[model samples]
Each structure stands twice: as structure tokens, then as C-alpha cells.
Target: MENSKMLSPEQLYEKKIHVIGRITILMGIGLSLLVPILLWIYYGVFPPMDNLLKGVFTVSSFMIPLSIAEILSFYPILGSGGIYMAYTTGNIANLKLPSAAIGMEVADVKPSTKEGEIISTIAMSGSVIMCELILVVGVFLLGPISVKLNSPMLKPAFQHILPALFGSIGAYYILKDWKLSVIPMIIGILFSAFNVPTSVAVPICVLCSIYAAKFLYKRGRISL
Candidate 1:
């Protein structure tokens, strides 16, 4: 208690974030399992242990590695509070990541800095709330929306949404530091040519970007 009182405001804030983050993570896990547990109890049915183990193994084979890679790649940008909220709410790559990036950009905050962390957390919270509200509204509108989305003329445009979204964001960063972007861009092109799965490509691209930045910084081609 005395030590905490002696700590700086930033230190106290970090301590609180960690404690609350852990509690929320545990609660999220419980909530995720609640529905399945309730259904199991009501039906008095359970899958065989072997079948469950096989299912777990199948998913874990790919998901564990992908999850580790995502954590490594995203942690620097998202920070503690932001990461907790983003992971809790889901849709990290498509929604939370873009929202955080745009938020920090608009606020002119560098990632990993105190300002960046606060902005990221706020952005993620907003994204989650907006997403939930959109989903609630979408439930009623889905039938009509799907019909329009599946129309032949609109189908082609819909197919480009992810590319358009990422491209706009990527263009800004690439322009900001073209030299640092070179090696990673080349690697990304190669991966795309090879039809690499995003789960596998993400970690590879992250590693390339790190090394490329280091090389450029050392050679006096780029600066922090």
C-alpha cells in the first residue's frame, strides 16, 4: 500500500490496468463457456473425450501459432489496455486494429507512447460499442441487405472491401517511411504471389519489417 502510494501516476495506472485486465479476461472466458455449459446441462449430453480432443487438436494446430504471431505483431501498437479491450471484443484485424491505427494517427500519437495507449483504448471501446449496435440493427436488416449485397453488379465491389480498407491505411505508412517499407513490401508481394495464408504471412511480414527497419536505421537511411 505504501509502495503503491509512492508510485508515479503512470505506474499506478499501469498496475490498475493489469489487475483489471486479468479479471476481465477471466470473466470473458467464463462468459464464452457459459452457453455451452448450460446447453450441456440441459441436454444431459457430452461429446466423447476422444472426439473433443481431436477437435481441439485440429484447431490448435493452426490457431495457436497464429495467435502467438498476432500477439507479437499487435502488442506494440495496441499496448496493455487497448489489447485487453480489443481481444475481449473480437474482430481485431478487421475492425479494432484499423480503428486504433486511425485514432492514433488522427491524434498524432506514436504507438507505444502514453498518449497512443490512451487513444487506442478509447478507439477500441468505441469500436466495440458501435459494432454491437450495428450488429443489433443488422439482425433485422440482414435479409434485405444480403439481397442487395449478393446482386451480381454489387458482388464485385464487395469483394474488394478488405483490399480497399487495408490499402488506404498501408498507403499512408508506406509513404511516411518508404525506405523502411521496401523490404516488407517486397516480401508481401512475394507472399501474395505464392498465395500464402494470412495467418502464416502475418508473422513473416512482421519479422521482415522489424529487420528491415533495423537495417535502414543502422545504414543512416532512416531515423526514429
Candidate 2:
């Protein structure tokens, strides 16, 4: 009788843990889809090519350190926050604080208490402040020097650099689940080709991919 009672409690605990795990995975998936959509929309509207390239580089350069910080946050295991932070701060001329605040909204996880939300907000804000300062100084000191040197090559050089950097970050995950990855990438490309807004296209493509993957997995067509 005692063993039966203990078994019930153990099973209950396991059930609760499983639920929590599912919730976390779902939250990570949601943020992974949502944040990119928001960034794409913002870029589409603002269209800052010079700052965009710089921001991409800055984000790429700090990916390792920011990823560590994100891991410590006990949020999603993916280092998207760091990448988002880098992209936002690198591009916007003077809106880092507001951008970070918006980022926190997009990155918020369920079951995150008020305190946790505040902490995420503050952390992102601090990152923006520091990154903005560095970007300003670099542009001021370096921009003129490059122009004076007639380095027309620098623009294209950095343009190629940003795409390569972002592509590398994306490749990290793509290689993990290549079979599942292709579905979303193809959908996203097709959606983008239609000139659909990034905010809508991203989530739509993600949902489509997720449902398709589940369908294929259940049918034994894919390992997942």
C-alpha cells in the first residue's frame, strides 16, 4: 500500500516536470519565430543599410559572449537574444533603449515573473547602452578615415560580411535538423517572395513548418 502511494506521487511529479518541459520548448519555439519577424518588419520600414551592416557585424562579433549571458538567464538555450540585441543596437542611430524594451516584449517567456521581466529589460538596456557607445565612437573615428582613404571597397566588403555572419549563425541550427529545417526555409522564402510583411510571414512559415514536420514524423516519413 505504501509503495502504491509513493508510486502515485512519483508519477505526479514526473507529469508536472514533463508539462514544464513542453511549455519551455513551446516558448522557445514561439520566440524563435516571433523575434525575427519583428526585426524584419522594423528593418523593412526603417531601411538603414549602413547601420544594418554594422549592426549585423556587431551582433556576429559578440555572439559568443552574449550566448553565454543568455544561457545564464535560464531562458531558451538558443542565443537569439544576443543576436537580436546586436542587430538592433548596431542599426538604430539612437533608439537602443526603446529597441531593447521592445526586444524584451518579444522575448518574454510565460511563467516569467515581474522580477524576471524587469531583469531581462535591464540586461538588454545595458547591452544597448554599451553597444551604442562603441558604435558611435567607431563610426565617428573610423568613418572619416575610411572616406578620406577613398576606400569605396569598404562598403561592399562589410555588406558581404554581414550576410556571411548572419548565415553562419543560422547554419548552426540548420545543420541540427536539416530535414525539418528545409520545410520552414522554403516556406519563408516563398512567403517573402510574395512581399508579405515579415511579421506575418515568419510566424506563418514557422507554424506551417512545425505542423508539416509533425505530420511527417507521425507518418514515419521523417525521423525528427
Candidate 3:
């Protein structure tokens, strides 16, 4: 009790955030499994154990690597609360990442800082709410929306949406410190040219960027 009372505000906040984040993650897992479990029970449909294991192995082979890479790459930037919220709500790369990055940028807060964590969490929550609302509206207007989206005029734009979004975000940072960005950009381009898998490429890029940054900093070419 005395030690707990003596903890700093930051320590207390960290403890609280971890407890809440753990609970949220557990709930997310339960909810994800609940639907499949319910459907199986209701329909009395169950796959043979061998087939089920095969299917799981095939999917996990592709997904597990990517999942591990994404968690490692995004955790430092998103922090704990932001991570829990983003993963729980899904759409991390497209929505939550951009929202959190922009929020932190606008707030002039660096990642891993207290201010960054709060801003990131808030940005993630806002994105989740907006996503839910858009999904609800989309469900009601699915037919019209599908027709519009499928139109040739809009099809190209939809097809390239992810690239366009990331390009815009990348342009900002690349322009901000073109020197530090050069090595990573070249690495990414080469990896893409060779059709490297993203799961493998992401960690390679991260490591290359880190070494590049360190080398540049040692030479006084860029400030950390």
C-alpha cells in the first residue's frame, strides 16, 4: 500500500492503461471467436480435425509472419493503448495509423511520449467511431454505393486508394527529411520490384532505416 501510494503519476497511469488494455484485448478475442462458435453449434457443422488443422496451418503460414511484423513495426509508434484499440477495432494500416500519425504531428508530440500515447489513443477512438458510423450508413445504402463504386470512372480511384493515401503521407515525411528517407525509399522500391512479400520486407526496411539513421547521425548529416 505504501509503495503503491508512492508511485509516480506516470507509473500509475501506465499500470492502469496496461490493465485496461489487457481486458480489452481478451474481450476482442472472445468476440472474434464467439460468432464462429455460435454458427458451428447452431448448424452442427464441424470440419474433420485433419482438414481443420490443414486449413489453419495454411492460413497461419501466410498470416502469422505478417501479424508478427505488423505488431513489431507499429507498437513503438502506437504505444499500448493505441495498439489495443487499433487491433481490437481493425483497419490499423489504413485508418488508425494515418489518424494517429496525423494527430501526433498536429499536436507536435513524439511517439513513445506520454502526450503521444494520449493523442494516439484518442485518434484511434475517433477513427473507430467514424468507421462504425460509416459502416452503418454503408449497410443501408449498399446497393447504390456498390453500383457507384463499381463504375469504371471510380473503379481506378478505389483500386489505388491505399497507394494514394500512403503516398501522400510518405511524401510529407520524405520531404521533411529527404536524406534520412532516401535509403529506406530505395530499399522499399527494390523490394517491390522483386515482388518481395510485405511480411519479410517490412522488418528489412525497418532495420535498414535504423542503421541508415544511425550512420547519418554519427556523421552529423542529420539530427535525431
Cα RMSD of all models vs. native, in order, equals: 2.7, 15.7, 2.3
Better of 1 and 3 by lDDT: 1
CA error at residue 117 for candidate 2, angstroms: 14
Clashing pairs in 3: none
> Which pairs clash (backbone N, Cα, C closer than 3 Å) in model 2?
none
- Give, for candidate 2, the lowest lDDT window spanning 10 residues: 74-83
| Deviation in Å, model 2, residue 161 alpha carbon | 3.9
| Residue 149 displacement in candidate 1 (angstroms) | 4.6
lDDT of 2 by residue, 78-124 (tens): 12333344333344213432344344545663213443344444556
Candidate 3 is scored at a TM of: 0.86
Candidate with maximal lDDT:
1
TM-score of each: 0.83, 0.38, 0.86
Any runs in candidate 1 off by more than 4 Å, and if so which? 44-48, 143-164, 192-200
Sliding window of 10 residues with minimal summed lDDT for model 1: 168-177
lDDT of 3: 0.87
TM-score of 1: 0.83
Tens digit of per-residue lDDT, candidate 3, span 1-224:
78779999989888888899899999989999998899899998788999999999988876888788788878877998888888888988878988898899889998878899899889888989999999999899997768777888887788888889888878877887899899998999999999998768887887888889999999999974
Candidates ranked, most accurate by lDDT first: 1, 3, 2
